[model samples]
Target chain A: MKKIASIIALAVVFGATSASAQTLKTVKDRGILNCGSNGSLAGFGLPDAQGKWAGLDVDFCRAMAAAVFGDDKKVKYVPLSAKDRFTALQSGEVDVLARNTTWTSSRDTQLGLNFAGVNYYDGQGFMVRTALKVKSALELGDASVCVQQGTTTELNLADYFRANKMKLKTVTFATSNEAIKAYDTGRCDAFTTDASGLYAERLRLANAADHIVLPEIISKEPLGPAVRHGDDQWFDVAKWTLNAMINAEELGITSANVAEMAKSDNPDIKRLLGSEGSYGEQLGLSKDWALNIIKLVGNYGESFERNVGAGSPLKIERGLNNLWTKGGLQYAPPVR
Target chain B: MSIDLRAGSPPARVPFYNYPKVRSIAYQVALCAVIAFLVWGAASNAIDNLQKANIASGFGFWDNTAGFDISQSLIPYTNQSTYGRAFWVGLLNTLLVAGIGIVFATIIGFVVGIARLSKNWLVNRAASGYVETIRNIPLLLQLLFWYNAVLKALPDLRDSVKIPGGAFLNNRGLFMPEPIAQTGFGFVLIAIAAGIVGSIGYYIWAKRRQDKTGQQAPVFLVSLGLIVGVPLAVFFAAGLPLTFSYPEAGRFNIRGGIEVVPEFAALLFGLSIYTAAFIAEVVRAGIRAVSHGQTEAAYSLGLRPQPTLRLIVVPQAMRVIIPPLTSQYLNLTKNSTLAVAIGYPDLVQIFTGTVLNQTGQAVEVVAITMAVYLTISLTTSLFMNIYNSRIALVER
Candidate 1:
C-alpha cells in the first residue's frame, strides 16, 4: 500500500512539472487563454445565469488576451475557489490567475509566483447594520462577527481585536456567501472582510441599506493576478498588462479615445500606447499591445467603474484604488 | 507461468536453492526492493518539485505564529499561539467531538437495537424506522440539516429562549452556566478519586471472599456507598468550592456563559445520530446471533427474564458485537472530518484548511493531518481490539 501510494505521489510531482515550464508557448499553441477566476464573488468574477463571465478579474484576463492576440474574446475564464486558485496557477492549469487573490509577501517570495500588480487596494473592514448604531470598530466590544473560513480575513479579525484589546466572538463559514448569509440573518453582530468584499457582500444582504461599513481599514489586501516563475515572458506580459491599464487611466486615455491618443505628439503618450518605443516588444508583444488592451477592455478606471464601482450594482467607492494623481496609492512607472 | 512445476515434486531431488520455499523468499525480497525503489523515486521527485517551486520543505513552519482564530477549541488557543499549538488545539477538538460521539452513539445504539427486539408492535416499528431513516441519509446532508434547518432555525440571540438554570438558547447555541473551580476544588477531586479506589478494592475483596466461603457479602451496597455517598459527604466538607457563572442576557447576545457554539452542537448531533444507526444494526445482528436456547436455559435455571437478558444475552451479544463496534468507532472518528463542511474547527479544518492555505505547505500539512487521523483510528482500534479479545468465547 505504501509503495503504491508513493508511486502515485511521484507521478503527480512529475506530471506537475511538465508544460508549465513554457507557459506562454503552451498558451499560444492552445490558441486560447485559460484564466483562473473566482466565479462566486459578485463584483470580482461571478458568472451570470447564462454562463457569461463578468467581473474586474475577468476583464483583466481579457485584457491580457487582447494584448497577446489583439482579441479579448479569445480568452476563457475558469472559475476557481479560494483553495484551488493558487495551486491552479502553480500547476500551469491556467495561463494566468486573475482571481481576487491577495498579493502577500509570502505568496510573492515563496510560492514560485509573481503578483503582477495590485488591481484592487482592499483592506479588512467591518460591516454592521445601521440599526446597531455602532460608530467604530473599536466600540464593538464583545461583538459576534461572522467571517469566511480559511482566508486572511479571519487572521486580520484576530489581529485587529487583539491589538485593540477588545473581546470578540467569531462565527466562521466555508464561503463568503455562507458567511454573509449568516450575518444577514442576525447570527452575528458584525460582518468582516475586505472593504471591497464588504461592499459586494452588503449588496447581497436582505436589507442592503441597513448595513454600514466601518471606517477602519485594519489590514492591507492588495488583490491582483499572479503568474508562475521561470516563464519570465508570461510574467512580464501579465505584469505589463496591469501597468498599461494604469498608465492609460493616468494619461486620460479612455477606450473610445485610445486610438486617437496613440497618435498624440506627447512623447509619454506616444511611448505608453507603444507608438514610439519597443516597450511592448520588450515583453514579447507587438508595439501596439497597450493600444490593443485599451481598445478591447478599456483602462483601469473604466474597468473598475464598469464592474465594481458606482456604474455596477456593487457601488463600491474607489477609495484607495484610484490613481496617485487623485491622492490614491495606485502609481505605475513610465512605459519607457 | 514460467515455473516448471508439472510434477508435485521434482522426479529427482531438486537442489534446496531451487526449492519453492526458497523461490518464495526470493519473490518476497524482489517485492520489497521494488517498493523501496518506488518510495525513493517519489521522495526525490517531491524534493525536486519543492526546489523548483522555491518552497522550503521542512517542519519549521510549525513554530511560526498561526495568526488565525478557531471558533471552538478544547485547549487554550489564540491568534498569537504558534502553529504547533494550533495543531494541538485542532487535535484536541477532533478527539473531543469523536470521544463524545462514541459514548452517545453506543448508548443510543444499544437502546434502539434492543427496542427492535421488543414484543410490542409500536416499539419494534419505531426502532426499525429510526435505523432505516437515519442510516439512509448521507452524513454530510444530515450535518447541514442539523446546522441550518434545525439549529439555525432557532430564534435570534435577542429573542433567546430562557431555559431553566438561567441558560439561554438561540441560533447561536445552548448557553449554559460556566462552572468555575474555586479554591479547595482539589479536595473534591481527591474525594472522587478515593471513592473510586475504595469501591474497586471492596469489589475485589468480595469476589475473593465469596470464592473462599459460600457467604456473598453485601458488595453492591458497600461499593455504592463509597462511590456515591462518600462523594456527597465530601462535597459538603469541601464547602462546595464550585460556583456557576451564569450567562447574562444582553441586548445583542448573551455573555459570560459556556456557550456550546452551533457549529459544534450540530456536528456532534449529526455524527452521533448517523453513526448510531449503523451501530444499531450491528447490535441487533449480534443479539440475534445468540441461540434462543441460551435465554430459555437461563430462565430454566430460575433466572428472571430481565436478569436472563442482562446476564446471559448481553454478555454473549457483546462477544459478537465488539469487533464490528470497533470499526464503527473508527468510522465515527473518521467521519468527524465532515466537521469541515459545517465550520467545526476539527484537526483537518484548522491545520489543513487554514494553515495550509496561509503557508502553501500542502504536502506537509496533509501529511501531518493524515498522521493524526491514522493515530486516532489506530489507538481506538487497539483499545477496542483488547476489549473484544477479553470478551471472546473461551472453550477448552
Candidate 2:
C-alpha cells in the first residue's frame, strides 16, 4: 500500500515537470522572443551606451523576431558567456541562440542542438605586439599564449603548435576581457582567437596600433545561430530567415529598396518577398515573413557593413563572407 | 488467592504509545522515510530533465579526449589525454596547492598568533593589524589583487629579473633550475632514508633509557647528527651526483626549466596569507583558553619563560587549537576553487568548468566534483578528530 502511494506521488511530480517542445507557440504566447547573444564583443553582439544592442549577431536575432512577430523590437536579448551559451540554449532559457557560436559536429550532435546556417565565416588567428618584430606564427615557438576558456580557439592553438613541432604554453581565462587584459599587461607573448574577434578585441587594447594580427589562419570558424533539437518547425523558421537575408542581398535588395523591389516582376524577387508563392505559409508564418525580415533587419551585406566592416571601427575586409556569386562561401538555397 | 493485587497489577496498565522505546523508533523511522523520499525525488527529476533535453547521461564521456591543455599539471598530461586523466591531473594540482598552503599557513599563523600575545607593544600591534586587515576583506578580492596587481606587475619576459642561484622572475612566472639525479643519486636517497629510520629508533631508545634511569640522553643532538650529518657526508662521498639544469632566456620566454606559473604562485600566496589570519585568531583563542595559572605554576617551580611556554602551556593549549585549526585547513582547501577566476586550472576550473562544457555532462561532472570535496573535507576532519581525542583530558 505504501509503495503504491509513493509511486503515485512520483508520477505526479514527473508529469508536472515534463513540458512539451513547442518553442514557437510558447514564444508567441509570451509575446516576446528571447535571444542569447554575446553582449561584450564589439561589432558582433555588443549593446550601445543606451543599452540598445547593435551588431551582426544582434541583427540576426532581430531578423528572427521580425520573421515571427512582424516587429523587430519584440526581442529580449539575454547576454551569455561562452561557457553558458549552449547550456542556456539547451535548457530552453532562450528561443534561439544568435550568439557568435561556431557550428561544429561535436556541438551539433553531442550538445543536442542544430545549427541553422553560418552567418559569419571566421578562422582563428594570432595577434602580437608589433614591437616584437615577429612576422609569422612559426616564430612563436616556446611562447606563452593567452586564450579564452571553453572556445575552439584554445584547441586550435594547441593543435597548431603540436603540428608545427613547437613548444606551447597557454594561460586561459574565463572571459575574453581577462585574456586581453593578461595580454595587454604582458603576461603572454600572443593573444589568440577568431580573426574577427581579434579585430574586435584589438580596439579595447590601450595601444591598439602597436599590436598586429598575424597572417596565419589556423582553423575554420563558421559562426551561426543555433536552436534546440527536435523542433523542426522552429529550425525551419530560423534557417529560412538567414537564407532570406542572403537571397535578398544577392538580388540587390537593400533595406531602403525592399518595398520597391517587392513589386518587381522577377520570379526570385517576388517569391522571396512572399508574393509569388505560399512558401511562408509552409513554415507556419504569414505571407510577408521574408519581406518583414528584409525591411526591418536589412540584407546580410548591410548588416555586415554596419556592424563589422568598413563602416565600423573594426574595418575587417569581407574576405570570405561575400556572396557565392562574388567568390565567397555564403551560398543560400533558393526559396522556390 | 492470598496475593496482594496492588503489588503487580499496575504494571499491566501501561499502553504501547507510552513506551519510550517504541515512540523513539517510530520517530526515527518516519524521519528516514522522509529523507529517502526527498533524495529519490530529486534524482529522478534530474534524470527526467536530462532525458527530455536529449543530453547523453553517464560516465562514458570520461574516456573521451580532452583536447585542451592545462597551464599547470602535476601529473604527466597532454592534450591527447583522456578526460579521466585530466580529472586526476586537476585533482593532484588542487591537492598540491592545499597541502603546501596548509603548511605555510600553520607556520605563519603560529608566529603571528604568538606575537599577538607578546609583551612588546610593537609586535603585538603589528600582528593584530595583519589579522584584522586580511580577515575582514573577502578572499576572492585578495586573490585577484595578488594575481593582477602584484604578480602581473612583475617585469616582462624580455627583461626578466635574474635572481641568484639560477632563477628568473617575470610576469609569466618564476623559473628555477631543475635538479637532475644521475645513477649514483639513489645511494644518497637510500642513505637519507636510512638516516631517518636510525634517528627514530635512537629517539625511542633514548626515551626508554631516560625513563629507566635517573640520567638524560642528548637526544636532540644525536638525532640531528643522524638525520642531517649523515646525508651531507654521503652526498659529498658520492662525488655530488646531482646536477642542475638551468633555465635560459629565449626570444619569447624563459625556457628549459621548471616554471612555476604566476597563476599557481598567486593562488598559493593568496590562500596562505588569507587563511593564516583566521588561523591566527584561532590559535590566539586556543592559547588564551588555557588558564594562566599553569604558566605561573611553572615559573614558581624555577622554570624560565621559554621552558614554561614550551613544556607547560603549549601542550595544554593544543587541545583547544586542533579543532578550529582543522576548520581553517578545510576553508583554505575549498577556497582554492577561486583558481578559476585567475586561470589556475584547479579541479573545479578544469574538470567542472572546461570538461563539463566540452562533454555537456553537467550532472555527472558536478556530482563527481562535489564528492571529491566532501571526501577531502571528511578525511581532514577524521584525522583531526583522532588527534583531538588523543589529547583530550582523561576523567579521574
With a 3 Å backbone cut-off (N, CA, C), the pairs that clash in candidate 2 are none
lDDT of 2 by residue, B141-255 (tens): 9989999975657988888899999999999899999999987888889888998899899988988988899477887898888888998898999999999999999889887
CAPRI verdict on model 2?
A: acceptable
Q: Candidate 2: misplaced stretches above 4 Å?
A: A1-20, B1-31
Best by DockQ: 1
TM-score of each: 0.92, 0.94
Query: Which candidate wins on lDDT?
Result: 2
Chain A alone, TM-score per model: 0.91, 0.94
Candidate 1 lDDT at B240 equals 88
